[model samples]
Target: MGAHDAGTAGRGRGKRIVVLDYGSGNLRSAERALAHAGADVTVTADLTAAAGADGLVVPGVGAYAACMAGIEASGAGPVIAERVATGRPVLGICVGMQVLFAHGDEHGVVTKGLGLLPGGVTRLPAERLPHMGWNTVTPPAGSVLFAGLPADSRFYFVHSYGVLDRAALAEAGVRVTTAHHGTDFVAAVERGPLSAAQFHPEKSAETGALLLRNWLATVD
Candidate 1:
């Protein structure tokens, strides 16, 4: 069954969630946000805790290569792959979401990613370097993440690279969300137990909180 198929039944609140501390993400901020969303949150590098939690959050920032290095250094790469392989919930944020794809091309340097999604990260076609500030997104119909969120609600984003093509992801039955920052780019995605957001929901205020709560409801 898809992650949302698990349903919100018996979702008694305080789902145990691990915000992976791989040295690249805003650990404390993510932890606090998840906590405020009613999750029993933990920020740690313990793979055991990560694997065993009801939900695993992989938050990231900065360069793709650096985040990958931290994931490898912390031995989180395999654990994340394993979780997705077994149908456990995994959420990737910002560069965290970017690393789920096959590769990332940053300034002529190509680095490998976790390959959970079928695509590559590239520079946005926008005139601006980083697409910072608030922007609206177009979530697919029946989107669990965007459920209960207003259509015009905006989220915070800060990045230069993004996955531009959604064909492969859509062909694979992944629910794709899009946003524009000089060009249309992937804003979020969901398939089974793996969900990711290119924007920082933690910094997105109420819209983000509702999204986090929606994600938490999917955890078994």
Candidate 2:
């Protein structure tokens, strides 16, 4: 059995999770993975259903600016902010996580983010353009998202732009997780009911499943 299958042990049963459809992301894959993790999953653009769910997941792919545009066009921006303010559990994946930050600078064009988290997203200081494949992460002490996972456990990553500084987030009492591409960049972050990952857990197989299970455990 996979680590997720063994570790989750049906922990996600009965939890209602809404995968926010803002016109981006691998929606079906995320839905399937969450259901396998044991949550009753819903993929929809309906704000009411999203807001009422036990947990909310924001998934994104493609450029940072395009994802932000989708989030804005779908009218999910306010709902996401409200959910965070009300202490409801919300998870962002990939560019979904990036949009939660203050801004994203792609090439020279700067786009504003949700500002829920501090800092901006920029190209990694690496020779490679898109840092694809698997890498291990360094989760801070007391990380709920990474709890009980192996120290050397690797997660899938496929992005170039990322938040590099950990100081601002740490000062805000957010637990930061770091992984290296060319330099250390934010991998995941957890604070209160808000959590985000730079990698796609759905595509990550076992390790990703366990991470989703962990996030589900935090949902009320």
TM-score of each prediction: 0.94, 0.97
Prediction-by-prediction clash tally? 0, 0
lDDT tens digits by residue: candidate 1, 1-220: 3343234322516688999998999898998888877678889999999999989999999999999999999999999999999999999999999999999999999999999999999999999979999999999999999997789999999999999998999999999999999999999999999999999999999788778878988888
Off-target runs (Cα >4 Å) in candidate 1 are: 1-12
Instruction: List the RMSD of every prediction in angstroms.
Output: 4.3, 1.4
Tens-digit per-residue lDDT, 1-220, candidate 2: 6665765747889899999999999899999999989999999999999999999999999999999999999999999999999999999999999999999999899999999999999999999969999999999989999988899899998998999989999899999999999999999999999999998899998889899999988988
* Pairs clashing within candidate 2: none
Alpha carbon deviation, residue 24, candidate 1 (Å):
0.8
